[model samples]
Target: MKKLAKACLLITAVLFAAPKVHAQISIGVTISANVAPPALPVYVQPACPTDGYLWVPGYWAYDNDSEDYYWVPGVWVAPPTPGYLWTPAYWGYAGGVYGFHAGYWGRHVGFYGGINYGYGYGGVGFGGGAWSGNTFRYNTAVVNVNTTVVHNTYVDKTVIVNNNVTVNNHNSFNGPGGVTAQPRPEEMAAMKEQHVPATSQQQSHERTASQDKSQFASVNHGKPNNAAMNKVGGSHFTPNGQKAPRNNNNNANNNAANNGHQNNDAAKQPNVQQDGHANNNAMKTTDAEKQDQQPAQQQQHVQQQQHNQQQQHVQQQQHNQQQQHSQQQHKQPQQQHKSAPKPHTEQKHEK
Candidate 1:
């Protein structure tokens, strides 16, 4: 009886120790919760801030102390090594409990509970970008990248059309009410391959997010203020979904202020040119006014000449009338002399 009890005790100890050994071998942390995490928040991915940065989608992480789930914002980060891809974290429901499977870095993307975290994580595999010989190339069709900043890019719309990638659903887990996806053969192989855990920067990012109360699902109602970041410790989203200004360095702030001044000066240049055009228009208006006055001056001179000619004609008419009156007076005196001569002739005839 003693021998049989020893064997049973050995078997029991091995069984109890198996889980710990498996956990140690696993690449990521495992967490279980009684409730499901909130649905994935809808947000636009920040543009790739620089080349060689891979995108990590945002997900809900649980806090045991607060008994609430908090959001870890999506971010861009450099991989631990080249030729590695990120398999995002996800929640899986099994045996009436939700299990959290944390993310990891591997040569190929593994199954992520089929939860569609947008920007190339289309529920099955990562189609957002790929690496070509240590340089990561971004897919502009699904991923947002600043073309001026990131030069390595390509367009593949067929991936979305062929896979029927649905980004509108906000499901946060896999099981009864969430995504119903089974792992493909390739994903299974990827799961068995060697993996690297999240980087230190990624761990710090999650830790910082956990401390912020506003990131909790209970407070934000599944909508976190900082949904995605351009880079770790770089610009992140605000409450309004716009990127908050970078306050990490004073030099950046000064540069932004200087750029603002330059933009203001550039804006003012147009107004100055407009003022110059207005002055030219005023000068042209003055010239037009002078031209108008020239016509008026010529008309006034013509009117003055016509008045003078009328006065001269009136004087000539007066002179002619006075001469005619004098002639009449001289004719009256001649008539009187003829009458006197006729009277003398009549007296001679009577003698």
Candidate 2:
């Protein structure tokens, strides 16, 4: 009986230690840090190298091992789908410590702690551009796009913004001296809507940034040398860097010379490892009992957050249904009036 109890407890611990994953939007515990993250660095937006690419703004990301902040260089990336917009993460102070909010790819731009991550993300709805069908249009006023390559664009200087949130103050978080902005009603809707996780390329870019010492604020003091890149990986693609062309000819000499050479250091970045530090200590029954006693507060807080999420999702569903109905009403006549070869119907009834 004693052996069986011990085995069951070990199994329970293993299951609890594994991270929980959800199919749609990932809602997890907010990570907390004692120190406030460094201020946002000033960087020029790199031109959209190709069409269908969206710019992800630069921000400070915390490393668990170093316990210091590092700058993840902004890069233009293609979203998981055409309509999805990138919601940049932000730090918010609460419970006497700052918590990191993980961003997600949602149908609409969600509240990002009201941090104005410029270049179209001015602390509210995305001004970068809108998607027409499968093609993404660029806003030339804020977003830098090559007009020759990207023609589906317009000059919209007056981008929509929130009046409540301060613009361009350069505070990197939400609370205290930071931008104290709450999630608006529309933003709350986006939070509960279906979301897509960050792409593998984006994850790789973050991992690469974590490895770079120059990107750390302590080293460069908020102005990173490699501030932005055209692409995520597959090149040393700084906005101003020497370009080295590779010879891919099938000749025996060329093939032999390039066989051992590796390209794009960013492409070879390792996966972001878990920050768990395992201690091989035997469990005590009294300690387990003490953990159970503390569950009341933890469970209450989690339950409250879950309730808020459920309410938001319910409200979003209703809003979506209404919008969809309105759209159908508008399109019904246009669809009917469209010039098309009508299906033939027999006139036997009149006869």
List the candidate 2 regions with Cα displacement exceeding 4 Å.
Answer: 1-30, 160-167, 234-351
Clashing pairs in 1: none
**Candidate 2, 162-241: lDDT as tens digits:** 43111476699877798867777898788888988789999988877766665566666776667677778643333343
By TM-score, who's the top model here? 1
Candidate 1 segments whose C-alpha is farther than 4 A from its true place:
1-29, 161-166, 238-241, 245-351
Clashes per candidate (backbone, < 3 Å): 0, 0
